[model samples]
Target: MIEDRELQLLINDIFEYYGYDFSGYSRASFKRRVDRLYQMDGFSSFPEFLSRVRVDEAYFSRMIEEITVNVTEMFRDPAFYAVLRNEIIPVLATKPFIRIWHAGCSTGEEVYSMAILLKEANLLHKSLIYATDINTNVLDTAKSGVFPLRMMKTYSENYVAAGGREDFSNYYIANYGIAKFSSELSERMVFSQHNLVSDRSFNEFDIILCRNVLIYFDKDLQDRALHLFDDSLATLGYLALGTKETIKFSKMQEQYEQLRKEKIWKKIR
Candidate 1:
């Protein structure tokens, strides 16, 4: 087991060297990931592992990728997308233009999901999506908009369940074992690197979908991120979170009213 001092030094080294802040993440999760890295790399001692990472930048990048949660899929948790389509998009439709922030959007599946939803609703032409993640590797994958073709079967089911109007296959072309999404979907999106832990919110958005990303953060960091989201949303803007996440216990709960029990809230004040 890595000592607390060693863990602190390792976290500090990662931040100072890579500019990615894991210091605010949950200690238990952070420690578990670090231990997994140590075991995977065959390092018996944390100090020795740190010594190697200090000199091997490629290893450091891989460690960061391992430590960061990147699991996501198109229309994941179909019920949530159902609620968004049924309960939320109508509210957004009243607006002349809309800006959406897909915070921690790993590999852009959720970003494309939003675009498809907007397109089906005839709102895509007026919408702009800003997809951000701290991991550059995932961001590059997102920009390409290519996904394994095997996953499209599940995504097609999700699309149908989420009230898709057109054929699910209309959105992408199958090439070999990969599916490349339509360029029209990505033309309205801007992919960039943004760290939620240390970076301030860049623009006010009509809706913010930061799902499944905050469960790894401690309460203090969660509150900090919530405050940033609060500051970055327009009045009555929507805030969507992971199915397991809620703002009810946070300092800003009263400032937002629950639109659905499934983690969608609207700014009330």
Candidate 2:
């Protein structure tokens, strides 16, 4: 069994070594993930586990990937895309140039979804997307824009339901049971590694999509992230979140009006 004090030391060591702060993450989830790592590595004690992780860079990278959850899909929660297409794009169409940010974009599915949507709407040429995540492994996967071809049938249905005009097959080439998305879609996007917990905001955006990534954080961390979004958004800029996540309890709630239940919010000032 790993002692609490030893767990703290491990956490501190990770932060000091990698500059990735897991300190603000939920303790229960963090501990559960670490425990799983211990069992997988056959370590009976936390100290031994910590020493092994510290000494092995590849193992440490793998452990970070294990600890950071990266679950996403193309056109996830179709309704949110529906809302964006119906409610947001019309307004965005009026802008001369648009800058959108995808914070904590796991494997780039959502980023590709947005890019396809913008292209279909005839707005892709005018749009610049910044897709960021703390996990470099996931970011690299996202940059590849390759996904399981078996999943495309379901994704195609989502695309249509979200008001897609063209055939979904137009977006990618299918080869050996994998779908490789077109470079055209990726050309408009800049995928990079960014830690929302420790890094400051980089650019003001017309729209920010940070879905399903905040639930792992505590309220204080959530609030801090929201504040960063608030600062990074232009006046009346749009904010999108996961179905279960919301700014309702944050200090920024009053400053942004709920555009689509808890799915989207628009900064008022």
Candidate 3:
């Protein structure tokens, strides 16, 4: 609803008021999301939205949901999971215990995906998955592990392509147009709210999967996140990203070896 500079001021106000920093997000996509929020809320100007945000905490929560990207599904990018199952899990299985961080895990689909893979490999019982998201609402959703049954068909296709050996339907029970994934898959998973932009790394992980999340960030924020991952990972730990996201030009690129078409990388230095 206004020039980019004015919109940036609004973003700054949000940071000052709520401690949620969005200034490092990609400008074009951020503006588009903000514009959609403004239009949907019937705000006449950016200041109007800013005024509401400063005064209303709930409004700020809604803004965070709108501004942050959350597009995800079960076993997204099947080939990536295939590579992980074929090339990575075996190595991790040798560890006495495993710590996996699913950063930016929106609604927990892929967390469950990894859990299932670990279970099949006889590694789930000894593995701990820290699934974190910036938004608590989605973290709650992920905790519940319920999704629309209509999505099962698509997810099932992805499951097979990802080298699933059993019927995908076995993982969930269907009722009332929704499917609730088995709690067995969630037993070892911990879902929490974590801000990759500002939060410090909490644990050294054997594997970190942060797919499709950084494309929304500006270069500086992306580098900040990459550095965080670098610090959080154990030597020779794995880093998995979205297909479109890469470490090729990152300052830490040389510290990693790209594996399986760049969808996965291993920290070498």
Candidate 4:
């Protein structure tokens, strides 16, 4: 286990060595991840681990990737997507152009899922899905629109639960050990590396889904991210969070209206 003082030293060192900021993230999560890396690398001492992080750029990249490894899937919460498919899409469809940002998009499962939703709604022609993650490796995975073939069964089940009617297999071509989604869906997606902690809003969006990402941040960092989302969202746009996330007590509660059944908020003010 990484001691609190040692963790602070690492956080400071990482920020000074690399521009990435982990200071705002949850200490427990950071310590756990860093400790896992330390053990995996067979470091005998904290000094040795810190030195490896500081001196070897490649090891640092590996550390970032391991520390921020994201676990995500398509239509993660069926009811959430059901709400979007049945209610949210209609409202977004009225817009001249739909801009959706998948902030902290791990490996693009949800991004591709959104594209499928737009395609089903007959609005894919004008919808642009911008998917961003802090980790470049994951961004590259998302850019390729490929996922493990074994996971398709689970994703297909999620698709149906999310109100999808078409045979989900039609959306992708599976071969060997991977599934590659259609180019039609990928055509409208733009993938990039974006750091939610320090990066400012790039464009106004009708819908911004940062799902399952904010829970890892501390209260102040959560507020900062919510503020960024508020700035980036359009006047009547929606902000979606993970099932465990909420804005009820935060500063965003006054500006956004929460949905009755989901973790989504509409920017009314």
Candidate 5:
């Protein structure tokens, strides 16, 4: 395991050299990720691992891919999607155009899911979903709109639970253990690399979803991300987070109103 001091050193070095700040991430989670990489790479010592990380750009990229959490799947938290369909989409439909930002959108399963929702509501032609992640590797996968064929069963179940009525298989074409989603869905999505820790808010959005991501950040970073979302979200627009994440105790809590038992919040201020 990497020592506490050594983990801090790694965080400092990464920020100084790569301009990627992991300083505000949860210490335990960050340390565990680094240690996993350190062991998997068979580094004999901390200095050796640190030395390689410093000298090799490709290795640094590899380290980043391993360290940043990218675990996500389609229609995660079916109930949340149900709420979006039942309560949120109807209101958003009143607008001329809808823009949504998916921060830390790992592999973009939810973004695609959102596209399906808008399509069902007949709002896809006027809606654009911006999906951003820190890892370029995951961004590429998200852009492809391809996923393992085996995962479709669960995703389809999630879709139904989220109030989807159409045949889920119609959304994708299966080929040799891979399911490629329709171009219609991918056309409305824009995937790019974005670091929520250091990046500025680029556009106003009707909805911003950064689910299951803030749990990895320290309070300072979590607050920072929430503020960015607050700035990016249009007044009265909604911000959605993971079940365990919230803006309730943050400075922005007063500026937002939670949507019942779900994690969605509307920016009232």
Candidate 6:
């Protein structure tokens, strides 16, 4: 096992060399993932792994995929979506045009879910969903709007629980063990690479859903991310977070009002 200080230095070196910053992530999680990568790659020492990462661009990409967490599903924590349906979407409908930012939208499941929700609400044409993540590969998968057919059953259940009005199957076509969603759902969407740790806010938004992405970040980085969200959101805009994430400890806590049981906050200040 690499010593703690040495491992941290290696992480910093990757940031300096590759412009990929993981310093603000939880050290324990970073260590665990790095250790797993070391074992899986059969590197005799940590330094050997570092050497491969520094020189081999392909290996560095593989290393990033290993270290970053991207666990997500369609309509995850369905209650949250239900809240959005019953409460949030109605107010958003009042707007002439709605802009939703799905920060760290891994593989675009939730983005599609939001698009489907807006479609059912008769607001899809008036809305644009910007889905972003640090991983370009996942963004490519998201842009493709295709998923394994086997996961459809569960995703369908989640859709129903999230107050979906139509047959969930109406959203996609299944063939050869793959499901391709309708292009209509993807037409008003844009997928891009965005690193929360380093990227500045590009546009103001009415709603930002950054679910299940911040639990990996430590305090300072979490605060930095929250500030970025703050800067990106318009006044009275909605901000939704993962079930495990909270804004109570954040510097911007007082700037928002908890609007729903889920971690949905509205910027008031």
lDDT of each: 0.91, 0.90, 0.91, 0.93, 0.94, 0.91
lDDT of 2 by residue, 1-269 (tens): 56678778988998888787888888888888888878877887666788888899899988989888888888888888988888898899999999999999989999999999898889999999999999889999999999999999999998888888788999999999999999999999999888999889899899999998888998888988999999999998999988889998788888899874658899998
Give lDDT: candidate 3, residue 64.
82
Cα lDDT of candidate 6 equals 0.91
TM-score of each: 0.96, 0.97, 0.97, 0.98, 0.98, 0.98
Q: For candidate 6, lDDT tens digit of each residue in 87-159? A: 9999999999999999999899999999999999999999999999998888899999999999999999999
State the lDDT at 150 in candidate 1: 99
Candidate 3, residues 106-152, lDDT tens digits: the string is 88888999999999999999999999999888888899999999999
lDDT against true structure, model 1: 0.91
Model 4, which residues run further than 4 Å from truth? none
- Which digits, one per residue and each the tens of the lDDT, describe model 4 over residues 1-269? 77899999999999899888999999888889999988888888999989989999988989989999599999899999999999999999999999999999999999999999999999999999999999998888999989999999999999999999999999999999999999999999999888998899999999999998899999999999999999999999999999999988987799888889699999998
After superposition, the stretches of candidate 2 with alpha carbons farther than 4 Å from their true spots are: none
Better of 5 and 6 by lDDT: 5
Report the lDDT of model 1 for residue 147.
Answer: 97
Winner on TM-score between 2 and 3 is 3
lDDT of 5 by residue, 1-269 (tens): 88999999998999988999999999999999999999999999999999999999999989989999988888889999999999999999999999999999988899999999999999999999999999998899999999999999999999998889999999999999999999999899999999999999999999999999999999999999998999999999999999999888898888888899999999998
Q: Going through the candidates in order, what is the number of backbone clashes in each? A: 0, 0, 0, 0, 0, 0
Give candidate 3's root-mean-square deviation (CA, Å). 1.0
lDDT per residue, candidate 1, 1-269, as tens digits? 77778889998988887777788898988898888888888997877899887888988878878889999889898888988888889889999999999999999999999999999889999999999998888999999999999999999998888877688999999999999999999999999999889999899999999999899998888988999999999999999999889998788888889874678999989
Task: After the best TM-score superposition of candidate 3, give how far the Cα of residue 249 lies from its true spot, in angstroms.
Answer: 1.9
Model 6 TM-score? 0.98
Choose the strongest candidate by lDDT.
5
User: How much is 144 displaced in model 1, in angstroms?
Assistant: 0.6
Rate residue 22 of model 6 by lDDT. 90
